[model samples]
Target: MNNWIIITPEGITKSPNDTFYENFQVLGFVTATTKEAALVKLKENYSYINGSGFDEVWIYQLRFSNPNITYLGIEQEEDEFEDDFEREMVHKITCILEENCYTDITYDYFEEDSYFFEAYSDAFQEVRVDVKDETIEVYDRYIAEKHFVHFGDIKL
Candidate 1:
């Protein structure tokens, strides 16, 4: 299976008295055999309402194995972590050897021991994490490096 990113147009309402705002929203990530299958899977899994003012959903296949280009979003604050585990995990993930680099944790389904992250400097980078035997494997596609750290080693 391959990883894919789904994006859709969304309208946000700040408050009852505010006007509706339009923007592109990331639906989520899905794994499938192909792009068409990924779209079908996403539509079936997510209750996305299709209608006026909303553009067609855009799907992009993520090249995790040998990714050279990735999306770079705004820098996120480190204080978003709710606990020590999250804080440590984010720290370890974003410790890239690049100057002026920014990292965004796109997905952090920690309950499933899975994470999706993107980092940017001169080029975009993607990182995927998988946990096995209490050890987390960090795959940094941009640097073409793999890092393994035991969960116990992550000081809480």
Candidate 2:
């Protein structure tokens, strides 16, 4: 009851006006059953994640079994995971996703996390500094990172 896979969470959510918000990009899971419907769902999520927010792309692979659900980190055979494996994993089962949780192997690929840019960056990849007005901005759009500015920081 074990399907090897990966789970990478980046956080992809932004405002329509290209403003910075609680946005991220990260989801990599190994799929089981290979159902066309399931595949469609996965692909849709991937597209939406990549299409939105700064061009931050995250890909995860997931392979799991019935009861042995596992959301492996990302894939760092040598490195250890930051998540508390046994402690964080809850058996309450919130949403039964294909009856498969994750695989035994997991690693993380923080393409744009705290380590990538400023520590407080919501979307680190888009983090930028404006010398014209001495302002800090986290570009929210891949097509237009300059479209957004801190709500109150925009000097009139």
Candidate 3:
């Protein structure tokens, strides 16, 4: 059986045009026999927040694999370390993550040229994954402050 998880966007709203705020909450996993079954459960539980035009629900396939490392293009010294592939890979990923300042940075402008951040137990690394209808919008903290209050739970 395949496992799937639904990310419910709690306290999510648009403060202005092209700007949105939402604290994504994990709604737990759903056991199903196929991808279609998982999606069916997602659609069944979908609900819209009151007076909130946002209706998109994000779902992901749960994988048990180790987190992937994103390789950001960074210049490395040829003799930095003697054949230390893991160290080299970690350094490159760290460089890309640092350049973005670690604030929900996303890159999808070009195919095979996009990046995302994933924090593991001890370090942060970049990973490549095809985003479905992925959008990276500017978060307006000022506007979010005035319109929303987080209650530490789903407000439904």
The best candidate by TM-score is: 1
Candidate 2 stretches with Cα past 4 Å from truth are 1-40, 48-126, 140-156
Cα deviation at 64, candidate 2, in Å, is: 18
Evaluate model 3: give its lDDT. Answer: 0.43
Candidate 3 runs further than 4 Å off: 10-21, 42-54, 65-156
Instruction: Provide the lowest-lDDT 10-residue window in model 2.
Output: 89-98
User: Against the hidden reference, what TM-scores do the models get?
Assistant: 0.35, 0.21, 0.26
lDDT of 2 by residue, 32-59 (tens): 4544444445455446445444333343
Q: Which prediction has the highest lDDT against the true structure?
A: 1
C-alpha-based local distance difference test score of model 2: 0.31
Q: After superposition, how far is residue 105 of candidate 1 from its true place, in Å?
A: 7.9
Alpha carbon lDDT of each predicted model:
0.57, 0.31, 0.43
TM-score of 3: 0.26
lDDT (tens digit, per residue) of candidate 1 on 1-156: 988877776645454458667777666567899989998787665544333345677899887633354546757675666688866765664553222244443544354676656654323456566655555565555432245232222211
Query: Considering TM-score, which of the candidate structures 1 and 2 is the better prediction for this target?
Result: 1
TM-score of 1: 0.35
Residue 109 lDDT in candidate 2: 24
